[model samples]
Target: MAMNFFDQFDIPYILGTPLVIPALLFPVLMCLTTNRFLKNRHMTIQSWLLNKTTKQLLEPINTIGHKWASMFLTLFLMLILLNTLGLLPYTFTPTTQLSMNMAFAIPAWLMTILVGLRNQPTSSLGHLLPEGTPTPLIPMLVLIETVSLLIRPIALGVRLTANLTAGHLLMQLISTAVLTIMSSMTTTAMMALITLMLLTGLEMAVALIQAYVFVLLLTLYLQENI
Candidate 1:
């Protein structure tokens, strides 16, 4: 019962053996390149989508920051895969975990900060204080700005974790309800089953949107620095 309740969020194991790393890497590894060209229709479609998304994401970023294009695209694909795969039966979604989200968030956030500081120290520090501030409110505004700046990664991680967690929890509750009432309340259960199916479709869209948003935010951060 406990396993059924918490299985969506918890790290899943097979035969009592943990497989966290492999689960996380499976999506990424699936996209690994081969020497031969990808000639299949689906592979070609994927490549086309990748190309289009790359252009859209990099459009906002400056040429100087364009070097991170591959990283951004790969992260986007990995995230989408992870989120989508987790919707399947008896699978784990690492992005649903706050710790895992933070692991990705913090480093990416820090890299942008470091880039800003390294390439343009004055401009980076200048972000803490806006121009033409009144004397009395200077310290207060600076503190507020600094706190906001520092909280980006936390916001990023929590946003991803909360969104995924809520969606999965809702799906689980609806699914369980459907099962519990199916035998006794056939019509009502059928309605619920329809709702669940619709919600599943919505969740799949959310999965893709969240992945794009994550990487897009990262690009925006990098845009500020570069």
Candidate 2:
């Protein structure tokens, strides 16, 4: 069975749908984990940084592990699962959709802004503006900053969607070509199978790499703004 991109768009829920479920669930799970970690008796931000012993080092990682750790793990697992699931004989990957990717990216961008606002309400504006600049340059700077901020979500969404979409399409094309060649000779079937195996491995790596890139960028944004 071939997967249809549009089929994934069909609404499966009353309020929204399953198409958005993974995106929604990822953040929710992250938040819950973060809250639980924060409530732990041994997990405090101070303890995380100051403890230098091997066991204590592990404690610190476990302490604040909920905050960014939740986000990182959620993003990684979700992307990998979605990507691998799509590679199954016949299944659609939600990450391949722009809407789904946007759902993830928008939250990330918003979280970046939220962290900035929460940590530095007064200086947050300064992020968009240089400390010293001529009056005329201020307008240009504002325009540039606005565009840059707007691009964050767009870039994030496009990167994930494009990579997944392209990879799947490429795999499909390769499979088609292999099948065509296999029809002419029996030996070609082995070659085709090998090609498919290689492609599958590459796709798996791509899935992990994309997830890591997204999470890394998100963490950098939060660190910068916060």
Candidate 3:
């Protein structure tokens, strides 16, 4: 079969084979784990928060950290798994696509708004319009907030898709160059092979760092809205 950089994007999947299955499982797994953890200690949600560090940071969040963390970890795993899978021969990286990245990020952005609304029904919109602005500035503040809110998913999707796509493209270019050199000069091929090896290692690191960045930003967004 002919191989090319774009060919990896053609991965086929059944209805349930997409990343959403694991994405949904993430929260379920977290809930089960949290319940077991709590049951083992015989602690109520209130006592759990008063006792645990994760819960403590989530204190201002109306105890939503436990739930959000579950989702965050799920997203983290799905991204990490998808990124790492791309490293394997003949596998596709879902994260390299704008649709998939947006799928992951849009929910996170919406969750921030939902959490804000649930926690502060009266003042959630006020978050966009900070207190003590001049009457004339209300329109400007609303516009600014609207723009800022809209940017969250766009930024998240672009950052992740760009990083993963760039890394894979670089790897493909280096590998193709190595193969081309191997057909001509043995020494040059060896050098290209080493470079490719190093690039592979760096790609692995990028995979992890990108996942962490995605989760960290999601957490920060949650913190801000809650």
- Which one wins by TM-score: 1 or 3? 1
What candidate 1 gets wrong by more than 4 Å, as runs, is 1-4, 33-36
> What is candidate 3's lDDT per residue for 1-226, written digit by digit as tens?
3367766565456684765355445545644665445454455754565345344334445454667665665566566767787787856676788887898889888988898788876677777888899999999999999898889889989998888888888888878878887978889989988988998899999998888788777777777766
The model with the greatest lDDT is 1
For model 2, the superposed segments whose C-alpha errors exceed 4 Å read 1-66, 185-193
Candidate number with greatest TM-score: 1
lDDT against the true structure, each candidate:
0.88, 0.68, 0.74
Show the lowest summed lDDT stretch of 10 residues, model 2: 51-60
RMSD of each: 1.8, 7.8, 6.6
Report lDDT (Cα) of residue 119, candidate 3: 80
What are the TM-scores, per candidate, against the unseen true structure?
0.94, 0.69, 0.73
Residue lDDT tens for model 2, 1-226: 3465334434345455453465446545744665544546556753453333223212324333336655555565566666566676645576787887788889877987887788788777787888888898999998999899879989988998888877877777667767777768758776777887898899988887887677667766666665
RMSD of 1: 1.8
Q: Taking the tens digit of each residue's C-alpha lDDT, what string does model 1 give over 103-169? A: 9899999999999999998988898999999999999999999999999999999989888888988
